[model samples]
Target: MASISFWTTGNSGGSLTVRSTAGLRGLVEAAGFTEVEDAESPAEGRQVSDFAESGPRSMVDLVRGTGAPAVLVSFLDSDVGFVEAVTPGGGTWEALLNRAVADDYGIPLDRFPVEPAVKEALAWAAAAGLTPDEDLLLQALTGSAAFAEELSSLLLVALGLPDPS
Candidate 1:
């Protein structure tokens, strides 16, 4: 089974713990990735949280330091950013996401689907008076418990894994 570690940004309230987090964990598991609790020390299974104050580079470093395939899910109100940690065999996550968007929505990488998605989602959230948190954006998009599942499914399809319902 392929292993994938998940990390999230912008958890201000100490609420979005990746391991026991409500929405993402189930989706990741459903997508068939064996979740590695501690990518830094795989055997230790330690819980890790990258603070918003640490910036994106810290998250990038954390992901790269893992030496294994990993996904860093950022919840900030940016252009639907998906970055890949440089691992031995895995290709760029940006390329993967672009291709997935192209395949699913016919929006090529050059067109940049993430920007529009983020814009639309944020606009909807703002109109609804929702906070621009990860959970809200995710819930706005996938209706709770489906964000990671949906994203993982897209990524799995990009990686040629069997699509999970």
Candidate 2:
């Protein structure tokens, strides 16, 4: 009954939440990890004050406290850099994007209308001195299978699980 929680940033400012949980579960199963359905929204009943004070840390703590793994998926923006502070170092949004585009991952960048949005987001992150990548951004825009698999693998590694499939 192992579980993982997926959280995405950059949705509060009119951006969309990247709903990749289903895809992640499939990839995890394909990779030989047990899959657990998230039957409820983890954010349910969370106080605004809790989120306001702790931000993504609260979500991580909540998920981990439930005896499950937590995966924070961040969209590119100035505030998105906060993911680096909460998670282990060097797991930058940019690094995730690069991995998604690498061999085997093969994100079809041209298949989705993600270029315009990603360009805007990258510019925003750069302006804030953050080197955010476009992988999650593309996923948020298109939810392509390649991006989904890339994201699932990233989360699996972050959760200290094997990702061979």
Candidate 3:
């Protein structure tokens, strides 16, 4: 069985969307994906404030432990279409994420999606017609654990929508 993961860019375009997260999770489940937690990040010693840093850690760890093939819902920040090969060791961060995209998103050698995800996330962030950058993207991406902190931004897009990036 494959352990499928949907890695969102948090709030694409600067809007928080929980429904979007749920939508993707639902799709992954429909695709027969079992939710596997990731690994914990190396602590740097500070106030444990952000859930984004920790939430995915457990999931990452679980996937590594299971040795299950993964499908990453690609929220790629760039334009490389990386289809993954799940090797025996199969424990590298990039490998696991690539597998999640390739195995789950079904990346092809010839055709691949654009990087840096100019998807709805970006659109949502561009409310008031303001352009968002990578720094803003990271902040919006981590604003919440399961939803965008701001809801009005994603009035059109659902939180759990599939990766259109």
Candidate 4:
């Protein structure tokens, strides 16, 4: 429950591996986010007033810019959530907490992963060269109709993203 939307890059002992803030800015801007600003608390992280206009592309560019796995998680009132990730080798994955809620918001369900892709989590871990909790990762990928905050937290841990808090 950090924020409605946020980007997190892979970290080594809490240190980010993103090449530089400028590179990150370029990626974010390319993804259709304008006026990107660095988050004061999280080093090498950025926050937007709302979710990115091009979420999946933004995530892909994040991995490309950081040269490591990257994650983007967004929630609405902690009731519905969406999470997307991309590995360094171009592997991409995502999941949605509540497809119905997303559709209600006029957000296209097809744009997000509505079905289960638990195996992709393992693939992401392997590509990232890290061992994550299998059970937690699977559950995160499975997603639930409620408790979007929990889903977001699970994704953060499953992908080995640092906890800004």
Top of the candidates by TM-score: 4
Per-residue lDDT over 1-165 for candidate 3, one digit per residue giving the tens place of the 0 to 100 score: 122124333312111111121223333233332442222222221000112211234333323433332223223332111212121233221211222333343444123232333243344334312344544433332222222223112221232222222
Candidate ranking (TM-score, best to worst): 4, 1, 2, 3
Candidate 4 residue spans exceeding 4 A from truth: 1-27, 34-37, 40-52, 98-116, 143-147
Supply the TM-score for candidate 3.
0.20
Kindly list the per-residue Cα lDDT of model 4 for residues 1-165, writing each as its tens digit.
111233221110011123234445556666554445543234444322233234335566666665767555555565566666677777776666555656676756555553444677667767766567777776665556565666666665665544444
lDDT of candidate 1 at residue 90, scale 0 to 100: 34
Better of 1 and 3 by TM-score: 1
Global lDDT of each model?
0.31, 0.30, 0.27, 0.53
The 10 consecutive residues of candidate 2 with the worst lDDT sum are: 45-54
Instruction: Give a tens-digit lDDT track for model 1, residues 7-77.
Output: 22432211111222223333333333232232222113322232232233432343334433333433322
- Let me know the TM-score candidate 2 reaches against the reference structure: 0.24
Question: What TM-score against the true fold does each predicted structure earn?
Answer: 0.30, 0.24, 0.20, 0.59
lDDT per residue as tens, model 2, 1-165? 111112232222111111123433333223232222322322322111101112324333433333222333333321221122122221223223333332233433332234554564455444333455466455443333333334433332332223312
Q: Model 1 off-target regions past 4 Å?
A: 1-54, 76-85, 88-91, 95-149, 157-165
In angstroms, how far off is 113's CA in candidate 3?
14
Off by over 4 Å in 2: 1-57, 67-69, 74-95, 98-145, 154-159
Give the winner by lDDT: 4
